[model samples]
Target: MRKKYLFIGLFIFAILFTFGCTSGNNPKDSFQKYVDAWEKQDYKTMYTFLSPSSKKSISEKDFIAKYTNIYNGIEVNKISVAPDYPKSFKKDSDGNTSIPFKVTMSTVAGNIKFNDTAYFSNNTKDSSNPWSLNWNIKMIYPDLNTDDKIRIDKTFGKRGEIKDANGSYLAQNSYIESVGIVPEKLGADAENSKKQIADILKIDKGVIDKALSASYVLPDMFIQIDNLSMDDTDRLSSLAKIPGVMLKKTPARVYPLKEKAALLTGYVQPISADELKKLSSQGYSKDDSIGKSGLEKIYEKQLKATDGAEIYITDKEGKKLKTIVKKTEQNGKDINLTIDSNIQSALYDQYKVDSGTAVAMNPKTGAVLALVSAPGYDPNDFVLGMSKDKWNSLQNDPNKPLLNRFQATFAPGSSFKPITAAIGLKTGKLDPNADKNISGLKWQKDSSWGNYYVTRDAAYNSPANLLNALVYSDNIYFAKTALDIGKDNFINETKKFGIGKTLPFEYGLDASKISPDNSIKDDIGLADSGYGQGQVLMNPVQLVSIYTSFVNNGNIIAPYLNAAKGTPGKILESNVFSQDISNTILNDLTQVVSNPAGTGYGAYMPNLPLAGKTGTAEIKKSQTDTTGTENGWFIATNTNNPKLLVLEMYENVKNKGGSHYVVPNVKSIFEQFCK
Candidate 1:
């Protein structure tokens, strides 16, 4: 009995051994081992193949160290040896026989399943001589049941809509369904799929061919182009009939007003390298979107939308079967602005013909009504991608089409007279009645000076009183006031007026408006500033705020910004100041604008009941010209309404028949708006 049992065990062992000897070696693993041995110059293995280098200088140690490290789906799985391929004798470019070998690549890099077949026939003519991969890797990314799998997902959050102040949709958010595919699932037809898709999308077929032919491993499917005429929401329904394509729902950024508020609203682009690095450092990927310019950039965190990722469950055939993991996308915070889209649109339409800015704000609340910088672009231009031609035109334009001048420089011109008037009254140096004594003041320095004219027969000129000073925008009249107030006091007063500072707003800003220097005590400098020239400058909004202070009774209120944090909304900060000199500046300014000979007579707005001043400063024409145009300006405030301030500036040079050119432009806008 013992002998019989032992014979049975031995027979079983022999059967097991015979089976192990025939198929025990993992074909894929054994093939790799043979390749590794051949690489190391093992004579036995090398005998079976041609030596790449006759010298065989690399030792096994060196060979092991030199092996390239690649992380891929194949590397992740324990692959089995494949069946031997049909004998092939392929000719090289030099007419050498091509060796044929077969390999059973795993379904994917990590998954152990396999489908399809790989036939390796040596290709001696391809330029790159790249290793070709064959066989099918079932995509398990989407669920096994095609209908149950998700093709694409929102990046992180639900998309937010863009709306105007009146709750009108200007730029809105919507979802687009797109079809995606796994290259391996198509087997030998991946190339055909690429060509077909490219042709349907009306793109360069070569691009598709290159992408498809170069793909050795299955790559993430990105739907580059889609049916433009078809409804985005119904994309899946139409595309399901397309070959090797799956459907996914995704949200895209959109622009509503298009070119209307393009410049102001700005545009969005794919995250840049630097921007991507910023996000990666914050634990985000390169797919995130960031603001490129304008309001979007200024308020990136608020306007930016959030995206969510989809966790796909794929079948063994490499087809997405289901989503076992998913987090609901969270949309980004919505931003409500102070800009009134309708008014801004109207102003932009008018400004399209000119290069200027239009700003409207409440004198009391400091809330900006419409802030416009001309030459607006279509914000949509930046949504998908910006063309180099469009970008170059804007960059190279002589008019500085992309620059925002509303809060930048408006060339104080005569509009600056209001501030000088305030400086005079604020410092207590102007005795509104001081000009009553029309005594000629001497130029303390006899040195050579700029184009300065102190009336040699000053006594002959009309009284240079504060009223007459603002009335005529007399350079000499205010020059006397500056000298009386002194430069130190002037600088201090100017800073208090909020110059050389940025207002808190949603749009990107230009921080160069007001500059005051005590060193500008020269009769020329002081005189220039007296009538709004030399070193003094202000923007339309700044001028409005300055005049508003006078109307607000000594309160120097900070400019209003549309971007701030509030309850269910953002609230901008408003700083107010009430100094003792309030009454002085207001009373004197009223007298100046009311004066019959006042240079600002044209500024009189009966319905608005405004007080104002006008100015014409001689500056250089352009950067290179020695003579610039006569810059015209008008600034006003209505104590009766007490909520609106208006400032007008015109760069009318003596060249284009002077004031006939630009002043009328400013007048027309003011008339339409104020009325």
Candidate 2:
């Protein structure tokens, strides 16, 4: 019995000894530990599993650096190292095992995938690690070797062009004649020549001083001062005569319409530092240009294409080795606008001295035909590096050339009377033919009103009804109509016309409002708002949309900017006015332009029958304030065709014939286009 127990214990000890030997000598186990460390990027732990000869060939620090440099240089991500080993241990003649593996990583250029084998041997001197990997530079990449190079080749995409309705290039990539300065060529007259250059360029002296102060500026290097328009042959000639002022042709973003379309097309400048950091991963660099405002800004992503690159490995002899990743460049898309260049140029021509905004639309389809803001700066000035003085001049101009006025709102004045009349007729609060029997240039509703009174021209105080009131722009007549509609009903119905709501346009517009907070506080406030005064303000685009309802059988059409999105009969407000009610207001608006006594009669043409209204919005602290200014407005379209509808407003038209100042402008546009 003693011999049997001792034999059983010896058998159990033999089984345990065999298990320890297999676990310590397993190549699969050692390879797993090395790969696990590799996955975690723990190079120190990976170094511990390297063979004695491999460790002597490269230091741990150098091994870690080589991996980090390659990974960072290619902007690598999703690094995967998958090992495929044989089910049974197979040793070669040298007593080493080979483990095949696959590596895949996503990089900026594209994806990189390769397969390689890792050789592990049990010839290590360390007792703790019997199995060790034989490391070399090829382990980093299959095609990699000492003195090989990894390089990135960048391919830039072309920026998109912006075109108008007639296929005219509003904004394009074209070259312009540029004037520059060679500091060393100035000779003894450097200061005089700089002054002459500034004078010819219309730039400030400080701009020249700043350019000269650049650290990289050399006496012989040509520093660009400004670009000249093709029409500026005289200025180019003037610049050529100046010493040290060299003329060169360079690539630029050219705006053919110049100041006529500056506010609409906008411009681009160099990518800012903040922009670069935010967009670095998307392939944006400091050399790129970004849109600053207008439609260029609204469609920046569509206009700016992604830059492509190819990352490759090369030997010391500059020979092609292997392409790690390759990406194809994509050019930007061309944006086609619905704007008519003829109408845009004509409208801008009328505003040489005044500050105003004009919006022309196709009343039937809601296509925006033209958007013009007067006193506009040349958009090309921005692309060619505008001088400090030139920039400051635009900023300091009182006319506020930088302000996008079409997106802004202003008092609609008496031009709002037609809208009020329509609303009144819809609510059954107004009778078109019935006389109000009020006789006065100014009147108020009872003694409850402190000192406010709704006034009209002294010549329009008889038989106050809707038709006669609109013809003469009788403010008191419409004021009474609004009070009858009541505050809550008026505000609610007005909001139905898209008032107090953001316009559904790609280009952002300030929402039109009934009042400051979309409410009328008192009868006086309500009365003033009735005539498009008080807190009432309307964007020119919104007003054109509202006016479109009159010509569209009582449905306000949705305004659109993109030419491809032209959907005729796309209604923004459905049935805001009944057909009969809309007809009545339309007939009255016609008489407002046709009748001799009408305020808008100045807009009447010989053969073209037009219908419209005129508004002179008073900007003052109180009704009695004589120091107030007026904004002149005229909204007109041909009743015969109902195709082209235009609304124009000029600021501070106090003495310039009031609303009549804008009458001829619209009339001329209709005479030219409506024919």
Candidate 3:
């Protein structure tokens, strides 16, 4: 019995030993473990699967370095390994085993798919040898060989063009010479060469030195100077002869409208280091040009193109061996605006001497036809690299050319009388036909309010109703009407018109303020607001929107630059006025331009019936003290079409007349386009 028990024990021990050997020598298990480590980027665990001979040839640090270097050039979004790719192990006659794998890597450049084999071996002659992988770089990329590496080549996509409503180019890419200096070629005369280049380019010599001093710039690399106009062939030829100077034609953003549309179209500049880091996930490089302001900045993503990429294997000397992947770059989408270039040019031409803004829109649809801000600068100056002196001149100019006057706020003056009239009619505080019988060229405010007095032009002393009051721009009549409506009703009516609220526009707008806190506390304040005087500030765009309600059956549609036939404009305030009130207001505005006694009579066009209001707002030192400086305004609409509304404002008019100064220009614009 003892002998039988010993035999059974020995047999059980042998079976257990056989099972342990089979598990240790399993090549499939070793390859799978190595693949799992690789997928997780656990290089330390991956190194554990390396064969003793392989580890002897390369250290763990070198193994990790090989993969990390390839990863730095590409953004890996995802890595997918096929579960059934390595179906079963295949044994070679030489006792080597291999497992096939299919890996798909999703990257910013696109997807990359490749098939590779992981080799494993077990030395049958050595009793203690376990299954081990003979890993190499080829296992990661099949095309990789000794002294060969994977390289990614990027091709930037074409930027889109900005076109006007008539399909005219506003901003587009044009070929310009990229001037630079090859530092290594400068030799011992680098300083002299830089001075000569700067003199020819009209740039500071320090700019060249700064470029050369960059840590990343190598001696052979070209340090950029500035983009020169293609028409500057004479300068290019002369500069090319100088040592270290080089010129290459490259596509650059160009503003065809230049000074005419500079404030509206804006410009682009090279991305900064901070922008590069923020936009890295979007594939933007430091060399890319991005919109800095205006519409260009607003539609950046739509105007920005997708870059293409080429992946290939390259030798140690950087010669391509084979192309693995190629992708075509997609151009950006073109942006169509509602601006009419011809009308825009006309508007700019008319306001050449004035420092102000003007906007014309389709009252029914709220499509802005033209927007002009005077004292404008050439956007091309920025695109072609503006000089510091020129930039400083623009910045220091008293007129403020860079300021977007369209979005700026100003006192609406008598142009706001219509809104006051509408509020009086809407609140049932004043009758359009009832005789207010207020008689004054100038009327003093009540002693309780202040010693201040409301004054009108000497020609407007007649008894007034709403129509004659608007026609004569009688400040006394309107102020009394506002007082009758009371302060609360006036505040509510103005708020209903979207005052004190920001307009939803792509270019951004300042909220029209009635007061600092949008409230009027005193009778004098109410009286001033009635004449569009007391702390009432409005923007041209928002003012146009308010005027649009009169022609649109009392629905105030927010004005938009990109409104089209199918895209409806946003309705900021609905039913702001009854149709009867709108018609009454329209009729009153018409008489203001048609009647010889009206203040807007200067804007009369014999061929066309025009409806508008004239305003002469005095700039005040305080709410009580009026300055001699005045701002002239004319807000007009065509009665024949009823679809157009134009607002013009000229600042600091001094003694150049009242709203009468801008009336002829408005008439000229109306006759030219409104007809």
The model with the greater lDDT, 1 or 3, is 3
Per-prediction TM-score to the true structure, in the order listed: 0.62, 0.79, 0.77
Which 10 residues in a row give candidate 2 its minimum summed lDDT?
279-288
Cα misplacement distance, residue 200 of candidate 3 (Å)? 4.1
The segments of candidate 2 whose C-alpha lies over 4 angstroms from its true place after superposition are 1-146, 177-249
- For each of the candidates, give the backbone clash count: 34, 0, 0
Which model, 1 or 3, shows the larger TM-score?
A: 3
lDDT per residue as tens, model 3, 111-154: 78998776778855545446788877687688888689889888
Query: Positional deviation of 562 in candidate 3, in angstroms?
Result: 1.9
- Tens digit of per-residue lDDT, candidate 2, span 468-551: 999988888889999999998899899889999999987899999987789899899899999999999999999999999898
Candidate 1 lDDT, tens digit per residue, 1-675?
999999999999998887654322213333344545433435345223322332154443433332222112112122333344334324346433322333232211112332333223233343232222221112222123423322334345543445555776555665444445555555576666666656565566675555555546355565344423224334345446556665666566666666666766666667777766456433234566676776677767766654555445454465765554444545666666656776666666754455656666667777666776666666665664455767898789887767766747655665676666667766667777665454554332345654345431123366666666665555556666777777777766776666666654445455434344324645566665665666666666766656667666656455555434422212222223344456655665665555555555544455545566655556764324665566555555566665545554444444543322433444455566655
TM-score of 1: 0.62
